[model samples]
Target: MKLANLSIAAILAASSFAIAQDAAPVDTDGDGMMSPEEVMAAFPDVNEDVFTAADTDGDGMLSMEEFAAAQEDGLIPAEEM
Candidate 1:
């Protein structure tokens, strides 16, 4: 039972990691960042204002880190992305 539990835990951990990786918004242009256009394409319902605000760097683009932060701050919904 202990071994089975450990195995299940490992599987869950791996799955979670994979999901997190897959959850990153596609960069589309391979620029290491996501433009508002790219984000809109992936999440049409996202508010432009919210997205602009989440762009903490004012770069007019969002890195994966920024995207995650937005999700955490409720500016973006995880399931919707």
Candidate 2:
């Protein structure tokens, strides 16, 4: 019984670690956190207003969809840093 419990605990711990690793990396833009600026910078030309728009979730922060939309809009460039 003890062995089974230990095995279960180990599996859970390993699963958590894997989940963390799969998560997105920290903000590289140095804006203190990952924001539209970082993603937009990676791609450029992303509409700044979309990121600033309050209607999208009303959180005042850009969601992954919004960021992706900006990319599709050509606001986020693929070159020029």
Candidate 3:
């Protein structure tokens, strides 16, 4: 049972890491920063506030961690918005 639990935990950790890697920070403008306008342009239907909310770090670019954290925070849902 102990081994099985460890294996499960390892698998979960690896999966999480893969997802985190795959959900890379988008460079929408090719200018090295993920600006609010870029995000808005990508999902025009989504409110401008969504991009602002996602950029939690206030670095002017929504890093992968920041975006994922935003989703976890309910600021931006899993959907396009």
Measured by lDDT, the strongest candidate is: 1
Better of 2 and 3 by lDDT: 3
Which tens-of-lDDT digit does each residue in 14-65 have in candidate 1? Answer: 8656545745545677676778887788887886898898899998988777
Q: Clashing residue pairs, candidate 3?
A: none
- Which residue pairs in candidate 2 collide? 43-76, 43-77, 44-75, 44-76, 44-77, 45-75, 46-75, 46-76
- The residue ranges of model 1 lying beyond 4 angstroms of the native Cα positions read 1-20, 23-25
In candidate 2, residue 54 scores what lDDT? 19
Model 2 quality (TM-score) = 0.35
TM-score quality measure for candidate 1: 0.65
TM-score of each: 0.65, 0.35, 0.50
Ranking by lDDT: 1, 3, 2
- The number of residue pairs in model 2 that clash at the backbone is 8
Candidate 3 wrongly placed segments (more than 4 Å): 1-16, 20-33
Angstrom error at residue 64, model 3: 0.2
Ordered list by TM-score, greatest first? 1, 3, 2
Per-residue C-alpha lDDT of model 3 across residues 8-27, encoded as one tens digit per residue: 99998886676455443344
Please give the RMSD of candidate 2 to the true structure. Answer: 8.1
Task: Name the better of 1 and 2 by TM-score.
Answer: 1
